[model samples]
Target: MIRFGVDRLVADPDLLGGAKRVGLVTNDAARMAADPARLARVALREAGVPITRLFGPEHGLNVQSADGVHVDDGIDTMTGLPIISLYGERYCPSPAVMRDLDVVLFDIPNVGARFYTYTWTLYHMMAACTAALVPIIVLDRPNPLGGDLSLAEGPVLDLAVRSFVGEDAIPIRHQLTNGELATLWQREQFAGVRLDVLSCDGWTRAMQWPDLQLPWVPTSPAMPSFESAQLYPGTCLFEATNLSVGRGTDIPFQQIGAPWLDVPAVLSDLARRVPKGVEFSEVTFVTGLAPYAGELCHGIKITVTSASALRPVALGLLLMAAVASTHRLRFQ
Candidate 1:
């Protein structure tokens, strides 16, 4: 079982050893166990740790965005604590941001895909903290999808394509816990950072977040549940193409279609091309934001009833091909 750093900190108060002040880089999704009422803040607060500040990544503490939406710095109305937006004007923490904290705790729920910007945010923060001589405490969580050593997917991002979306050459489905990635990164990517990882006790690399008995909160606007995270590494490629990734629907990444798509035909083609753990169903959607907004687009919903039998990245590639061949899908 992987020991979650947050669980470790809770179990052993001596880990902090009466450190008076602390800061946390987190979002609304950073909760303890399956309860939304019990968040990382409450866990730390109950343990008598004073979390002086709160830091939010891309989607803000509330995880509200239409993609590329930047969160602004403000006071958290709920926590009454000052909230800083690291995903604001800059992608990384400024030296000024790291100057006051003794130890900055990181405890964000990640989707386990390399292209997700949060991992890069963590890397850059770790690098900044390393430069400023502040220790980093990572309270780890399970990757929503099991961290099994599956065949990698997505393009190994070339340096030129390195935006916030694709930070490094890590595979699309990296299949590593955030803590493990942090450790590997500390040794090779940012060795100077004073990194301390508290792992999850009940978790294993083979266990996904849904198996961990934790509640699934949308880590970002589009990824609303464990199902979305499972399909995201692949379906997210829709962002590169001129397709509506179901932004307006209750189910975002799970439903993919465009006005130009022939839903039934595409589903049949996809079934013939690559059908395994997932199956496609005809569906129609109107995106509130992005690509085909307000226009009804026909497409298929890729459902993964059984996760262990699914290969998200491979399926994603197949879907990409199917869309490209059938409809003149353009990559942005």
Candidate 2:
């Protein structure tokens, strides 16, 4: 029942704004809700939008690359267009990539966490567009985690912890769609670029993805499901440490563990400490990937009982604290 920006754009191809050559910053996850088999690019092209090139974000346009894997630039066999990699070799479009395009369109789905690299990709694109004098259009999608500004979490990034994982002073659980974040960046930083947001209709600050009746699509390897994304704003921090946040495993952010972790003790602590919106269970898993592969580790499989009450940043830090306090030796 909800029409995402792609759907609206297709309904009226004029949204391309009379551009003859266009570049799209997108990934495989961006598909039309009405035609799930067709991607946003295909739909736009069918509707007569002249998309000349593409820009791949963190996971590559295919969305199959491993977490933090370097995606190299290549040609999209399906479209026969050059695909520029923003996650590798460069974090933004080179001036040359911008010169070939008359306009740029962005249509990637976001998991609603500041550390989820795609949001920052938009920031870099905004800066590049500003510098190149190319107007950028963002085909907004729903923030799977909901967009209630009041639910935002912080310990907002400062200069010390900034990196590809996070930057600026953006909060951790920033409850906004990617387009909204783009507008904020333009206002605070890249005001020189002309930014247009084709916002999704029927989406509101109070509605989470589950409420929309749309199928969940994985935009990144780790964020494979709603449950994983539910805990990602916090659990992703485990990657910064020696602990395993279940990557290279089936569950990814849904489960967290380290071989050295004492699951029972950590569980006992989290039982009383974690915030109201979540409930977690003890899980013993062997990751097939990194941090601790082939060896068994014990940790928690977090479940969201009430989305409204969860403070992801608070929950994540508390979980870390619990693990750290219980067994200082394994805490990192």
Top-scoring candidate (TM-score) = 2
Which segments of candidate 1 are over 4 A away from where they belong?
Answer: 1-3, 34-36, 329-332
For candidate 2, give the lDDT of residue 6. Answer: 86
Best by lDDT: 2
Q: Give the TM-score of candidate 1.
A: 0.93
Q: C-alpha displacement of 110 in model 1, angstroms?
A: 0.5
Q: Write the per-residue lDDT of candidate 1 for residues 197-281, one digit (tens) a residue.
A: 8877777667877667656777887787888888888888787778877876888889788787876666666767865698778
Q: Note the residue pairs that clash in candidate 2.
A: none
lDDT of 2 by residue, 145-256 (tens): 8988898887788878688878668888888888888888889998899999989888888998899887888888877788788888888887888888888777888788
Q: lDDT of all predictions, in order shown? A: 0.79, 0.86
What's model 1's overall lDDT?
Answer: 0.79
Q: Whole-model lDDT, candidate 2?
A: 0.86
Superposition error at 105 for model 2 (Å): 0.1
Tell me the number of clashing residue pairs for each predicted model: 10, 0
Error of 2 at 92 (Å): 1.2
